[model samples]
Target chain A: MPEITILTEQELRQCAAVDAGAVEIVSDAFSRLARGGVQMPPVMRLDVAEHNGEVDVKTAYVPGFDGFAIKVSPGFFDNPKLGLASVNGLMILHDSRTGVVRAVMLDNGYLTDVRTAAAGAVAARHLAPERVGTAAVLGAGVQARLQLKALTLVRPVERAVIWARDGEKARACAGELADELGIPVEAAADARTAVEQAQAVITTTPAGSPILHWDWLQPGTHVTCMGSDADSKNEVAPAVLANADGLVVDSRSQCAAMGELHHAIAQGALPADIQPAELGQVINGELPGRQAADEVTVADLTGTGVQDTAIAVRAERRATELGLGTRVQA
Target chain B: MPEITILTEQELRQCAAVDAGAVEIVSDAFSRLARGGVQMPPVMRLDVAEHNGEVDVKTAYVPGFDGFAIKVSPGFFDNPKLGLASVNGLMILHDSRTGVVRAVMLDNGYLTDVRTAAAGAVAARHLAPERVGTAAVLGAGVQARLQLKALTLVRPVERAVIWARDGEKARACAGELADELGIPVEAAADARTAVEQAQAVITTTPAGSPILHWDWLQPGTHVTCMGSDADSKNEVAPAVLANADGLVVDSRSQCAAMGELHHAIAQGALPADIQPAELGQVINGELPGRQAADEVTVADLTGTGVQDTAIAVRAERRATELGLGTRVQA
Candidate 1:
């Protein structure tokens, strides 16, 4: 029988968080992905329309890693109505050599959130100005707060702005984040106001149409759009992609299909034959990220399977160091 | 917190097995698949060529079922040399409505074997001769034994024959199966001899070249090929498919990619545009299975995600009834 470790959500929280180590881990995964020999298949998604729910399964095998991860993420949009979290899932880490499962991280989507936020930090680290005076985020959801926190780890974000359609929610989130991060976080009066002053901007909303306009961006500002994961969801105007000095995506094929790049191409704002650099390529120094100090850059993150593998491997290693999970014989 | 039932291999063995009930469950699942509305995605696969191993992930969401299943199956063919089983993995069952996991079945490939054998029985029940006097299998592996045992549940298989490249292993398997199933069994000298005397023949070997020829099949014989799961593996000659009176498949798209139909199409023995009827259609009376007693019907079982969901649901329900699993909070 193979011995398997089971890590609960609380245990996972202790081992992994939006910290410097996570950003480095995700950054290294992107660098490895760009170097090649990574087997990351297209994600598998199952939609249960009747219940307004969907489940996505992702996995990747990186050459140097001792183990690979398969993450199962379920999002039932209606769950929040029943006072339950909208997203819940677990990651199964398997030995790369023998294909035997090593651990099960029942983190209930914490690791996914952390990896997503860490990807934002990766983009900021490579594209944002070295000293960011202000960082702003659009949306007042869980990810909106985490993305800003993640940015603080990469850039010197002294102050932050929060903007959302729900003004009251935005104000409440700004106040909570202010106390949590020990930084000045104020609710912006409008989206334009938020983008005007920040050197770094992040969009984390499930908008079906564009919310940020092309004219709102300033030079030397780095914008990371983690929303627009589906074909129907768009947060940044298509014109913003056309006007940006540098455009990077987590996965070019995926971004062209479901990311903000998808919307840009569909709207003909970007040339049909245009080739955008991948974040991995930029991380590995194979492609240019921000060539000049006054150049505006944009990164479209459509979550990759490689990120899940990277984060799960880190969590399992940390848990092993701390002896945080229960061992079960299978 | 959701209460998750953890069922081990021993517990799963008590709940699910190769029997009449399992056949009925698998048959019903196939019928439902034919009826449509089941959300079964393409199987996800990861290959670790360095270790000579591969892993496949399959899932399905069947309507009207409270829970659906996701199965992770790993095949490390080299493990046998190290005194370990080549195949090992588990199934996870989730609540369909809420998208929350309900049970974890750590069956270590036992459930998969049962489900596969049950699928074989389902094919035999609908396609094989009504009263089979002699049944023959082409391999001396675990599935060869289970497939014959499964056949006995649906057809009156009085005696059986076993043939393999290793004659000693074949003879030993023949004796063991005869004693276990309470029937007369013999080891055939060659593939031709094994098919010549049996009313029903099953090909269960992982042969790269065809082992069962078209000329060896008789008019009343029904053949089920379950070994050619990958495109590189073949058990039945291409002529067998072109010459069969009734041809059926588990999933047309899957069969075209990696099953016997794939080889037949590649060999140009079968038409490229041919639309063979699915086995589900045969069971549901939507298509003809065996119109006459002398018709040579062949079923290409490529294995499907719906089968995993069906079998896991059955195992979980039975385990719940018997109180045969450990409950954990998630």
Candidate 2:
């Protein structure tokens, strides 16, 4: 019988973290993605309309990797009322050569959170100014804190501001992050106030309408929008892309369908024929990211399956080395 | 923390079997699929050409069910030389309301086998003649045996014939089935002789070319072609589909892409615009199946994600009722 290791969220947390190492790992995946040879199909989505929930299935087979990962993520918007988190999932890594189950990471989206944050850090490292003294996060959720924390690893983010529709929740999040990161963090009066004061901004909300406007962006400012993953969600105004000096996306095809670029093209703010440079291309030096120090760069991150496979492989290897998780005959 | 049940193949075998109940379960899923309101995504496939392997991911959300299932199946064709099974993977059942992981079934293709065989029985029950005295199965593999056994659940099959490219393996399979089913079973001289002796004929081999020709099919024979699930695989000649009196498919769109119909359409044996009735439609009485006793019917069984969800739900329920798995904090 083949053996499979089942690692829980706690075990996975001990293996992978949202730090410089994770950023580098994700960056390397992006570089390879630009060079080609990765087999990644379009994301499979299932909407449970009755339960106000949705599930997305993603996977990628990267060459030279011993294993590939398949990740299943479910989001129930009403789960908070039931005393549960909104997002939870598990990742399965299979041996590439034998197609055997190597490990099952019941991470409950911890690894996704890490990988997503690392992706944001990669964007900042490539597009943000040399020194980012203040970083603005437009959400009061788990991703807001992680994105800011990850930004600190890539940029000199000495202070941060939190802004959300609910001022009290934003204040609470800001206070928590202030102590956690040992940085001066405060809740902004509004989205405009947050964006106007920062050199680097990250949007991490599930908003259906634009919360950040084009007029709020300053020269040399870098924005990483990670909220608009679905067709219905939009974090920045369509004009933001139209007016930006540099536009990049994690996946150009995916962004054209569901990202901020989708809204831009639909609203006629950007030409329908426009094809922005992909983050992978910029990472591999095939295309430039931020051409000038004063250019306003925007990186729309809709996420990709390659990041999931990379993080899952890293977590499984570290957990196995640490002797964590339960092993059973598969 | 949420709790997740982990059931291995041994535990799954104790919970579900390829019997009448399994057939009914699968039949009801087909009926539901025809009635509408089922959220099933297209199968996601990853081809690892270097290792001669492939992985397919399938999932569906059926209304009124408490949970849905996502199945990951991997087939490495070269694994048999390394003393390993070519096909093995796991299924996950998630709560529909909360989007939380409820159970993990590590059946390693056992449940898939039972579900697939049950689907074959479903096709035979609805499309075959009322009295099926003899059944012929092409192939000497595990599915060939299970398909024959499942036919006995729906029809009064007293005798069976086994045929394969390897005559010795066919003879061995015939002996095993004769002992297991308590029925007279024999190895046929060729595919023609096998189909000529039985009222119900099933094709279960993964042949890329036409293994069963049009001229081999006898009058009043009901054929269930289950081997051509991929684009490159074809079990029966295109003329069989063109000459059949009644043709049904599990999913019209899927069959047109990768099933026997795909071959027929490509060869111009069937019209490019042909839209055959689905098995679900026939089961729900929306369309006709086996119109007459002497009708030469062909039911293409390409399989569907709804079948996986049905079988996984049944297995999890039975396993939970019997306390047949290990429960861990998810």
Candidate 3:
């Protein structure tokens, strides 16, 4: 009988610590995605309006990978008020040869957190300036903290500035980052204060309306916005995309549906001369990023199935090395 | 922490005997589906070409039900030759309000088979004439045998005729059914011979091209074609759909994608005067079925998500009542 391994959330937490290896794995995934041999289907979404919840299923297969993952992510928007998490999920990995169940990673969004943060670091490694400066983060949520932690691995970021609608949450986030990264982090008075003096600014808000404006961007600043993953979400204004010298998105088709680019195109604010390029292309060096030292760049990240597949494959390997999880003849 | 009950294949096999209750449950699911309150997403398909296999994820939510089910079915076409079953899967039952896993049914496609046969019975119950002499099943597979058994519950079927690509397999299937159902069964020389004298006919072959033709069907026959769930599979000729006196489909949207209706539409074989009604509409009395005793009625079932959810719910309840699963904290 074939054994199906069950990797519980606690076990996943024991093995998956976001590190440079995760960044490299996801970076290679992006390169493969740009190489054009992967098959990732469009996400399947089920919206439960009565419970203010939505579940998204994503899957992908890289031709050379030993296995692939189908991740189920559910967002219960009203859960936070009820003292529960808003997002939770698991990933199912299957054998590529026999299409049999290999492992079930019950991460409850932990792997997604790691992969998304790793993507942020990849974006920074390719697009952010090499010199030392403070990075600005516009949110005090889980993503805001993870992005800053990931960014510190690639760039010489000495400090960070945080901005959020809730000022107290922003202050608490700043303190947590300062202690964790051993860098001076401060809470910004507003979004403009956060953006005006940073080398790389990351927007991580789940705002319904634009939270950051274009006029506040500094020259040569690279902005990575990772929060606007749905149609109703917006972090930066449409003008911000038009104003950037180069605009890159994780997936063009996904952005056209629920990304900031879709909002910008709807508002007629995107520039005609600047054609958007995929981040994978930029990472693979097929497309140019930061052509000039003083040119502003923006990358929108809505997540991709390739990253999930990559991370799941990596997690399964790590679990084996650590001798974690229960194996059952399922 | 919540406990997740695991119903293994052996356990499911011990409890999942096809009965009239499954028919009623699925019949009600179709009614709920047609009543327009269920939340079911489009199917998510992942292809594993290396294994000559594909996996489908299906789910549905009926409004007043306490829980719903998401089923993952994988078809490894080459496995049977490798000494393993070609089809296997499990269903996950989750609390609708909390979005938490309540049970995991390791059915190995047993629940799907039972539910599918139950759906066929439900279809025959509503569409078939009050009495049937002999029902012809056009396949010599697991579904072919189960469908005949299920049909006996709703109709007075005393004999069966089966035709398959391999005449030897057809004869074996006939022998098995005769021993199990206490009915006279025979292997037909051809598809025409199978349908010519039958009162009710079922097409259950996963044929790539048309195997059954419109001209072979007899008057007063009710045909339930349940194999063409994918675009590449077509069991009955398009002309068969055109020749039916009345046509009812599980879902019009699904039929337009992968059912016999799609092929019929592609070939321009559909009639201009008849608008296809949903099976739920016919079951709920919102539409008519088999208008005359001598009419040729066709029901195209592309297997809806509601049926999966309903069957899973029923399986979970029956398992609990019988104390048939191991509940482990996952």
Candidate 4:
């Protein structure tokens, strides 16, 4: 039997990160997906209502790639009461050439957080305004901070605003982002205020109701709706999606099934039969991105297996280069 | 983050097994499934034709169970030419209470093999004839050997016959089973000869075409079609399924989607809308198994995520009892 390598979170963080070329890797993966060069199956999502938790299993095999990843992401919503962070999981990468598992990434959800942030960066790079000064994020969470840190990889921002249902968490998130990114980040007075003052906006809250509305958006703002990955979670209003000049989704079918697009279609704000263009098409230059300087664009990133596979491939390569894992036969 | 436990194949073998109460655990799981207490989604199956590889992700949250399992099973059909076994993978067990990962069973496909074999045994315990002196198996592979070993836990078998496309592999399998089980096992002249001499027939090949026909079975013989889990794989002919006195499937929906029943329905031998009795129903005593002494019963084992979760829960319990596996926070 072939041996397997185990990469812990410490090594993974040292090797692959959201700040370091993750946007490029995930951006390329999206391009391949749009070009029909990837084989991605429908995600296997299991809702463990007993624990108020849900797990989504995602995977994809990219043609010509030597490896693929089966990512297991679990969100335990009620974990905070027990002093737990509420989300956890890992990614298992296999040798696509032979179907042999080559490495087990015990990332404990860090990889997912970074990859998600990178996906947001990819959206910002392709759709955001050329001269972005200030950015706004709806949500004070790991992603709120990580997304800002990641967006710096694509768009330059001098200041940022954070809005959250919990006012204190928003202030804390803003402070953390300011310290980490060395930029002027502060809490916004309201979601509308945040949306009106920024050239780019990223929604990262797990809100069950519409938190960002169409009327609040600036004319040329590029919005990355990144929270509505489940049926019950909607971060942006349906009108916001329907009113956008350009709308792209990670996967049209998935967006229609579990993302913000599903809620929009359910509410009759968006047509049920509309086949939205994938963000990959925009990234691949097959579709127009930011066609006009004042065109309001929205990218729905419900997440995709292709991103997981791409991030994992890069992580493994970097892990190997740094000699940062233990090879075990047992 | 909660700690993660890694249970290797060696420790898994020493702690838990298919013959040791797996049927009871899996049988209970099946009953729960039949009672609508299992939250099992559609399987995520991705086929990579470049390597003749296919990876299936199956998971279920069985209500009232303290944990669930997400199983990643891969089959690379061309691995045998490189002197490697074609099937491999692992199971990730998560705590139901907090949605935290409890253990990683690096069984190297051992758990899958055993759980599958145990499912066949569960079928035999409920549906097979009372008086079984001999058994026959088509296709001499890992499953072929494991199924016989598992069946012994449910029925008293004195002898067995093996038939395979490769005559040499069949002879070798027979020799190995005979020496291992202390029973008179030998290769059959043909599939018909094997079927004619046994009370139970288990077909375990990944053949794309049918190997067993309707006319090949005796009166009172029970057929377990265990190989046809994919759309392109078949073990028994459609005519055989159409002619059976009783036809039960592990999962009615799955069987209709991509199992032997799929082929039968496609060929018009079985009605497309006919909802077959689930093996769980038979196990739960909600439906009849073998109605009469001369009745021919066939069980289509498409496999289920419920069984994986049940087996994984048991394996984790046993591993914990044995004080096995390495614990880490990653």
Candidate 5:
């Protein structure tokens, strides 16, 4: 049996140095998916409880491959009260040639969080203005923090405004982030205030209600909506989507059912023919991203399976080099 | 943080009592899936050439309830050379309520193999004749042994015939199985002779070529094809599928792509609307199974995501009760 390399969160965090290399890998997988080189089964989820609604599971099987990853992400709203952090899981890597076990990655959702943040960086790299200086972020959660960090990595964002329902929490989160990133950060009093003076905005809240309004967003502002992964979840108001000069998404099929686009379509605010450019196409240079700096663009980040596969592949390699975690022989 | 339950193959084998219970849960999941209560995403694999066409990464996410299992199962061809088992991997259970990581299951593919075999048994129970006195197993592998054991648990088989390219291995495997089950077992000289005397036939070889012939099967012989999960793989001759009185499979979409049915259709032996009954439908009484005692029935065992989820859920519960493996708080 080949030695299967296990990657933990710490190892994965260290591997971030080479993460730029993974952008293309993920881009290619998505391109293959679009070109019919990959097979992505329809997303399916089981409703374990009424409070949780439904947990969505999505799978993709590439041919001539022996490894398959199953992501079991549950939506448990009551977990915080139980003193547990939500969103924890591992990614299992398989050797497709022999159908043997490869390695177990105890990602604990760190991979998901990082890959998603990296995707945001990918989106901002191609879709944001060439001279991005200010960013407005909605929600004060971990994802929100990661989004800001990822955005700054790609764009030259010197200042960021954070907004949340709980003002104190947002202020504290912004203060902590400002210290970490060595940038100016402010806690906005309201959603409008956050967007008014920003060149780009990212919504990372799980609010089912529309929070970002079209009237609040400036013409040159680029919005990256990372929430609304289910039909019941919405972050950007439908008008913002309708009036945007350009729209981009990780997967159009996914965004059609969940994501901000789904809500926009359901409300009859956005036309069905308004095709969003797949982020992979933009990354591959097949499609133009952000046609004009002044044009309003929204990159809907509902997430994709290809990102999970890419990160797993990269993390496995990095961990093997760093000598992290336990190597299990299969 | 809640305690995480991890079950290795050894622990899982010690808790054999849970296997039967797992079968019931899997059966229910399949039934629900057939009834449209469950949804499964497509299976995706990432092949790393260093691993010899085996997938180094895999992700499967079922969207209905936000849960997915990512597994890195390597190739078996490398195991004997490396002095290890070919099939190994873990399953991660996520909480849908909060998208939190719930439990990490170091199944090492034991649970997967058991669940898969149980599915074969479920198919045999509904499709095979009530008096299945004689059975022929075409492969002398672990799956073949498990299939026979599971079949015996569901149906009464007086004798079993085993056939493999390697006669000695087949004999040894059959002898060990017979000693365990206390059933008469014999090694057949060839594939034709094996099915000729048996009322039910099972093909579990990983061979890409068709191994079984249609003419050798008896009128009432129920055939279960457990191999041929990839597009390049096939176990049953196309004529065998064409001549069957009724056909069934785990999932229609999967069978149409990579399952045994896919091979038959690709060869122009089967039509697009063959409309094979899902095993779940038969189990749920939503569709008729074997119509007559002499009817030739075939059930394609392509596998489904529902089985993975069901088994993962059951294993997690059992491991929790037994206090097995490590627990990590995320």
Candidate 6:
């Protein structure tokens, strides 16, 4: 067995801003996935109760690689009650040559956060308008914060508005993020006010009901929906999706099942012929991302196994080089 | 993320025989699996090269449980060359409630090997006829040795015959195992000679070609084949399967694809309606295991994810209670 080094949540947070090493891995995974060189097993879900759902397990096997990542993310019930975050996991790296497990990284949804955020950046870089300067963010959760951080990396945002049900949480989140990114971030009174003036809007709430209104979106606005990972969860209104010029998703199959697109299609708001291109195709320049600067574009940001594998691989290497955590040999 | 405990290979080996707690876990896993309460995903395989095959990533989710185990067993080419055992892996146990990763167990295939061996024992206890004494083992590798050890735990074996292509290696394995178990063991020069006098036989080589001949088996002899796990791997002759009065397997789909039954069906020797009983059913008493003392029975053993999850859960608890490894929290 190979020597394995683990990275804690603190280590992962410390390395979050400097994850250039992980970007390459994420890019490679995306390329391999787009080329059909990777075998991702269907994402299995187990319903804990009628109201709560958890991703039972998600896994992928890349042909040339020895190991794969199995991800399990439980529901978000405890987050609000315990003052703790939901969605934690570990990525195990196995040796492809000897079937030996090489490393285990405590992703804690950190890598997931990074890769998903990077993917958001990737989407903004390709799908958002060239002159994207104003942005609106819905929700004050970790995903909402990361999405903003990642969007700023690709697009030059001059001002940003944040809106959440909890006024204090949104204000604090806006203030902290604004200070960190050196951008003007103000808390908006409602979703309509937050998204109406922005060129790019991101909905990151875990609300099952539609939060973003169709009338709030401007003519050239690009909307990135990051919540709604389950069948019952919806972040954007069906009318908003129908008004978009083009829809892009991380994976068409995923978006058509449990994502926001699924709800849109169910409501007959999105046509059956709406075949969204995968994020990889846009990143690889295989498909056109955003056709016109003022075109209304939307990218359904359902996560993928490729992202988990990519970031886990990178984090494992970094943890090893830095002697970040305890080493366990198996 | 939850606190994670790391267990190394050396630590596992040190606790192997002494850890009855881990054995109970293996037992419970089989029981739970037998009860139809566990969901084990299909095992995927990736052939990196012509001679190297890796057991690709596998994940399992049990409903009502917060975490799942992701297993990655890489290719096994370098182990023999490096004078080390091949097939090492780790299991990451995450919190089913929060998806926070809880522990990383460096199984080093120790838990896998043990659970597999325990499954063999379970099969023998249910499939084999009572009053069995002599046993024949084909191949003197690690699995062959474990099979004998586990079989003896459930059956009162008086003597054993071990056979391998290399006589010296077989002799060494037989001598060492016999000394450990206090049973008479002899190294057989040929495959047929090994099974000629034994009432039970186990084939554990990775030979693609047939090793066990049908004519060498007695009428009532029980055969357990555990070597064939990939599309290109087979151990027993198809004629042996044809001659068996009853056939059983861990999973029918898996057996039809990669087990000994796969070879038989490929050669048109066994009909598609062969309808092997699932090991789970037999264990749960839903299907009869062994009927007649003079009936030839064969059990095709392909490893399962339930075993990995069961063993990992058990090992984690035991290791924690014993304070056996280093724990890191995030």
Fraction of true contacts retained by every candidate, in order, equals 0.63, 0.89, 0.29, 0.70, 0.43, 0.48
Across B4-65, the per-residue lDDT of candidate 3 in tens digits comes to: 77677777776666788888898999998889878998999988787788889888878777
Candidate 2 residue spans exceeding 4 A from truth = none
**Total clashing pairs for each candidate:** 0, 0, 0, 0, 72, 12
Q: Sort all candidates by DockQ, best to worst.
A: 2, 1, 4, 3, 6, 5
lDDT of 5 by residue, A1-330 (tens): 245555565656776432456555555566665565555555555555534434545445544334444454555556668776545556665544555546566666677787788788888888888776779999999888988888877788889999999999999999999998899999999999899988989999999898999998887888999987778899989988889988889889889988898988888998876688888787667788888868999999888776666666666667768776665442
Better of 1 and 5 by DockQ: 1
Report residue A55 deviation for candidate 3 (angstroms).
1.1
- Answer with 1 or 4, whichever has the higher lDDT: 1
A-chain TM-score of every model: 0.98, 0.98, 0.97, 0.97, 0.91, 0.91
Alpha carbon deviation, residue A148, candidate 6 (Å): 0.9
Candidate 6 docking DockQ: 0.36
Candidate 6 per-residue lDDT over residues A5-112, each given as its tens digit: 666778866554424455556666776788775766667664434224354456566655445565555555655466666556655655544545555556566767
Name the TM-score of candidate 6: 0.88
Residue ranges of candidate 6 with Cα displaced over 4 Å:
A18-32, A35-41, A44-85, A94-102, A213-215, A237-243, A263-275, A316-323, B18-25, B44-55, B59-69, B76-85, B94-100, B237-243, B262-275
Sort candidate 4 into its docking category: medium
Candidate 3 residue lDDT tens string, A287-311 = 9877878888898999999899889
Question: Per-residue error at A240 for model 1, in Å?
Answer: 1.2
Q: What is residue A223's positional error in candidate 1, in angstroms?
A: 0.2
lDDT of 1 by residue, A1-330 (tens): 788887888899998999999998999899988898888888889988889999999998888888889999889999988887788888899888777878878888989999999999999989998878888899999899899999988777899999999999999999999999998999999999999998899999999999999888888998999987788899999988999999999998889989999999999999777789999999988998888899899999999988898999999999999988878777
List RMSD in Å for every model shown. Answer: 1.3, 1.4, 2.0, 1.9, 5.4, 3.7
- Give lDDT per model, in order: 0.90, 0.91, 0.85, 0.89, 0.75, 0.75
Q: Candidate 3 clashing pairs?
A: none
Q: TM-score per candidate, in order?
A: 0.98, 0.98, 0.96, 0.96, 0.77, 0.88
Q: Write the per-residue lDDT of candidate 4 for residues A121-147, one digit (tens) a residue.
A: 888888899877889999998888888
**Model 3 chain B: ten consecutive residues of lowest lDDT:** B266-275
